[model samples]
Target: MHNIMIICPDQSPLKESEKWLSRYGFHVNTSATIEQANRYYEWSEFHLLLIDQDSIASLENASSLLPSHLRRIVLDARPSLSTGVDSMAQGAIYYLPLPTDSETVLKHVVNALEQHDDTPQTDEATPSQQSDEDAFTLGTASSGIIGQCAPMQALFSDMRKIAGTDVTVLIRGESGTGKELVAKALHNLSHRHNQPIISVNCAAIPDNLIESELFGHEKGAFTGASTSHDGLIYAADKGTLFLDEIGELPLEAQARLLRVLQEGEIRKVGATQSTKVNIRLVTATHRDLIAMVRQGLFREDLYYRLYVMELLLPPLRDRGDDISVLSQMLLEKACQKHKRPIYHYNRAFDKAIRSHHWPGNVRELENAIERAVILSPPERVEAANLKLASHQSSTQQGTATLTQQGKTFTGTTLDDYLKYFVQTHQSTMTETQLAQSLGISRKSLWERRQKLEIAKK
Candidate 1:
């Protein structure tokens, strides 16, 4: 089930929404006060969040100040993303008008977390699984997100709590953190598990059409309105809606969303009558929402509405457990997907995966494994067989830029870069780590040192 937090000054509507969410298998926490919301953020990790528009305004910088990868659903009085489109574009995943019926809203929540693409239906597809949905089959994100690091242990615990309730969750972090996976885990465990989980990328969607995409339209609603249409929010009816990259939503849409959330209704494009819905909302983003609010690019009220129970996903580097575990998992999946028999990596290859910073997190790890498997023989994956551009270049004279901040000695030999990189990650390396860092055999490493006229450590 999902753990949801509801933050609203209006208790009656929030209570009713909680009850409706309960029907779908969610555990919800209700908090009207900012203090309670702050307390919840400190100790809990919620999967989905439902916020009153006014509350969003109040908690402007709350999510930006929190950790990363939180899923949130917002109830806007204006019920549009125009005003706070920057918020969604910055990183909150989905922004929708608060629905009157809890069930309908729950559907939206499900849709938001599950449906990012429209997949053509296949005859072989089962009834319980949607054609285009990419959900992780409930509770599976926990499998990949865990880490042995204490920070990760604590983070996972928080995630469990976040997943346990329906709270407006704001996730803040650098790019490549495990935010989306955390959001999915929350939806899987929530009361609204049976419905679809839909997601929208605020940063990816064009600004002009975002409003129409969220609230839907009646026939003749816009220039291309050939027929009546249901937007992302309505598609997620009876489900969980995940808005990723929420910080980027445009300012005008944010105002409309604020109104819809506050009033618990939405007026679709070209439709005078408001249609009621039930849904659980989850939002995620990598930007600093509070910072944007301060800059006047985000609506302060909308920020408060979404800050009820923010959850942060630690980066892969911060979660060492994920490094090894994810490598192994991706290795297997890559082998299977590529029809390669290679399963085990040589010592050099294993060390490479562990040592890399994994700037793209799990996504990066998966790609690395796929590349290795694709290049390997049918029965084995070895270090040399792997095609890492970094590793390949390191073997040559080229250097790889490892971080931001323009700290670069571009012409330095690959060997120097490796030494620098290894020195930087001393915690992950032991005194005998040079061979591993260079992805070469101990004997070959010595040969390279002599051939390249390199100084031995």
Candidate 2:
């Protein structure tokens, strides 16, 4: 049995967690203070440390007091993006918001311990091997995706496990969350790496041409089909076919795609015979596909086929310090692309980046960095160069005080505020725009609308 230490204030919930962990047969120790934690650490060999925010004065102090060899998990009673980022920066392997159930906590602990055990001991590794391992840990894995945050690290781990298999994958996230990157990484890591990976943007293609483009056409099959042509599906034979924005595909096209997936073959328009193809299907969408299926816009059969394996990408706001890391990486690339000298950004630029809720995710960040690189002076980039809109300014303008019937309301309650803001803005703004303005997910907005009986305009 492995030894584990829990550093937390004498809270009932955490104590309950301790009991649950002990029931699983692991040797567990609980410390109520930093001094006590240090004492326990010196007295016993612990493989993992679970520290709560209230146990120490600050993350910096907690990080300093903990041993470097032990895998650390930080729990926060009140979690925010900044706090989570700081905890990760302090070398915690995981940062979890508290009030989570013991089962969830146990799952994280088990996963962390398994990861620790799987890691090769570096004491006897050669310098080159150590360097390679360090690079992988730093998010320089063969996938070439950059991320050091716990969510991304976990995503990379999942990718490695799923890449070797031939199952269909559905990548889902808000736009600009790098779904394509995940799809590309999967193709690069799969057994069909040598085969061609064809990408199709279903939304970008004209509906009239989508069928012909995907399934091909025989000579004189249609007015535009002057010559026989192979479709994207056939082009991806023995390779991978990536269908981005699959949610936008027409219902007719969806049926044909479903048939292709089921039969592992395709027949061109007006073709008498079917052509066999062996390919992996990977799809991505920023839209709510289930909602589309309900509205009868998307085929349910295709949805089920694409849902074999789902990979969800966390948006930029939830990714914490990855914003800083990605910004710096994008800055260098932007400078090189524009043929400009490397330029540093001021603290104001950094603050603006951290403050803004990037609804566009990494794509927005890259555009902002490139814009700043092109517009800023040779020495430093300023907040103005980024051209980011102030969320606070918008909120202030929208939430101004109102008075009626000899009484004044400042929107004290969350429901009142949401009802007022959403009802007031739903007339002029689209659903997506309203969600972005309110700093919430579209699903959350819809749920709130249902709860408050606020109908969409």
Candidate 3:
């Protein structure tokens, strides 16, 4: 069991958190203040500190006073990019945003303790000390899915809870939030772990062939049916059938799917007999099915059936500290994959990522990292190598957006360009100073922060 000391002022959240962590098999203790927490730490060998964000200014002081073995994690009620960066600078190894669920807290605490225990004492490659190849392997193994942010932690908990059940699940998220990964994780942990999992992309299949693709057609069922074959659903009998981009499923196919769910059977095209299939169904889509149902694009009944257990994945830009961790991991992986010398990323690179909004989420970030790794020279990676702003919408193309008075940018919208400039330069300038530099009122700057979805300093 891992030992954790939570320093929080609010009794309600503290009690709730402690109760849940205890149930999850953790040795949890709590203090109302940092001073009291330090006293508790001196007596007990706690492996981690879960400090409230209110005491964040004192974090560095606490770290200096605590034993070297213990790691500090800040628990912010409303975490953001600015606070996340500051916490790391204050010596926090991890940041947990609120209102986080209990399961996410448990996972982060456990994982942090495990990593601390595994760290080498001497004469070994630490995270900063590891080479490209070693860092790629170590980071990937240690940071699978690349986040401990509140949203991701909640998603992890949901996956764990539903893994043992056979109920159908509908995962909803943006295009690159890794919905397919969640499906695979569910199958891997379910009773059908040993059974084969058949994955099909509904949008990838042509509308004319979708029926034949899902429900096998008999030989000569259509003009080109050369041989009688089992469908994907048939192939997945006694296993799992994962339908990705399920919102793109045709109406005719939706009716067929509804019948299969209702009767536990599938009828092949042009076949007289209906075949019984004992398989678990998992579907995912980035579109809103409810809205589609109202628009007559998707069947209401089918939508309800698939929506039995809805899991909404938070977008990448919302996961505060995760971007930094994931970027490093991706950079290392890209370097190792291409057999290039690893390039170290400086604070400027980190600032660049934190400032920009990731519209394409994880997929876009990985591509950017790979591009940088391939193009950058040996030694270190600079912000110019990232080229993230080039991915902005076409409407913003060739439009000059100024930053820091004379520094003009193109491609990205004014809001995004301003966010990038502010976040990158925040460490050097105060809010009032930055607002003045941009030639905008302080209130206007605050309004921009809200409009652009930026975290306040």
Candidate 4:
């Protein structure tokens, strides 16, 4: 029988896990101390080990006593961002934060088993983006987009139905709502699947050079244009061009872009010749473009052109399966990318997942999972596995600040207070710090910021 080691300070959760693994036909070995786990590691090789977060340091210290690689994983019940990151950087195979489920555990384990080939071949692992070269197959066969919720199913259905057509697409969503993912899905499922999906972030580009970038420029059209160049739109001739933050494009650029959409052709900045394109336009924006059009911030014709088909991605709070689906998906990716044996999310970790309203959506979820993966050891993850080290990030990442209730000062709104706070302590303050000082819960702080319109300074 294969060896399975589980280390815990408490007996109840350990006993529960023992039964869980035993039912799965794993020969379970339990330990109450890190010293015993270390001693056991010397005598036996484990298929998987589950370490309580309290004993994580012990397991890591034991790693130095061994010679070659052994499958290990950590179960952190209280996860701090730093410790999790530090654990992985120090050589842990997998990290599972508290309140995690059996399914999340199973997913990581399967991924890890597949990654460890026993062939003795050296393959360094690194994380990769969700790229075209690695497009996900359709149906329930993939782990790419995680969801069993109605909203996700509907969103998927909408994408599948609209992808095959050449109709322009308008994707509306708040920041972190995965608009880019929808855009990619549209292109991936479309007739132009093989062609490139060129992405241009409208807000990131400056107005002075926006024209030269969208349309080709003749040599000497502007300063430093020593060579004639093809523009981004031309490069995406037969594919889909994703215009992100489309509402940020200035009025002048919007007019020229509208002409291209209206005429299916573009003229160079300084060249007299015009070029035709056979591209599909997919635009996304966090702002309300319809309102913008009414206010003359957006062009009506351009709006109509891209609004032929529309899709809106829901935020993480709205996604009912936030914990199960995303945690499992991110775990699988982490195991595969790191070439480590998988682990499970213990009960404590799962609770946090359910309790926390993810302000950063999928990206934040991914970060949390990644932190768990890194903090964990190669052992299986358990409920008491994770430890939360660093505080929450909202106030730190943005300029949104806060003011004490009923403590009004001259020219001071909550937004102004927050801006000053962010500038002063961004490098050190976490959401916990602010909430602690404000005598509020993290969730309450988030709501207050949103209500106050206290955007990042």
lDDT per model vs. reference? 0.62, 0.76, 0.74, 0.66
Which is better, 3 or 4, measured by TM-score?
Answer: 3
Off by over 4 Å in 4: 1-143, 335-340, 377-457
Model 2: per-residue lDDT, tens digit, 1-457? 8788887888635666778788998789888877877655563377778888777644556666665556778887765444555666555666676777877688778867877673323224477654533333324423456675668877888887898798999998878888888888888877898899999987556668898999999999989788998999999999999998788688888888998899998999889999988999999987788887798887888899999989889989998757776776677779889999766644588798999888778887899889888889887876787877643345455454676445455754476778887777667887779889889987777656544546443
Separately for all candidates shown, the number of backbone clashes (residues 3 or more apart, or on different chains) is: 140, 0, 0, 44
* TM-score of model number 2: 0.62
Q: What is the TM-score of candidate 1?
A: 0.55
Per-residue lDDT of 435 in model 2: 84
Which tens-of-lDDT digit does each residue in 193-219 have in candidate 1? 788989887655656778888888899
Q: Write the per-residue lDDT of candidate 4 for residues 133-163, one digit (tens) a residue.
A: 1344321323234443556666876877788
Highest lDDT: which candidate?
Answer: 2
User: By TM-score, is 1 or 4 better?
Assistant: 4
- Worst ten in a row by lDDT for model 4: 121-130
Residue range 295-368, candidate 3, lDDT tens digits:
88899999888887888888889987678767776777788899987666567888988888877788878988
- For TM-score, the strongest prediction is 2
Clashes of 4: 44
RMSD of 2: 12.0
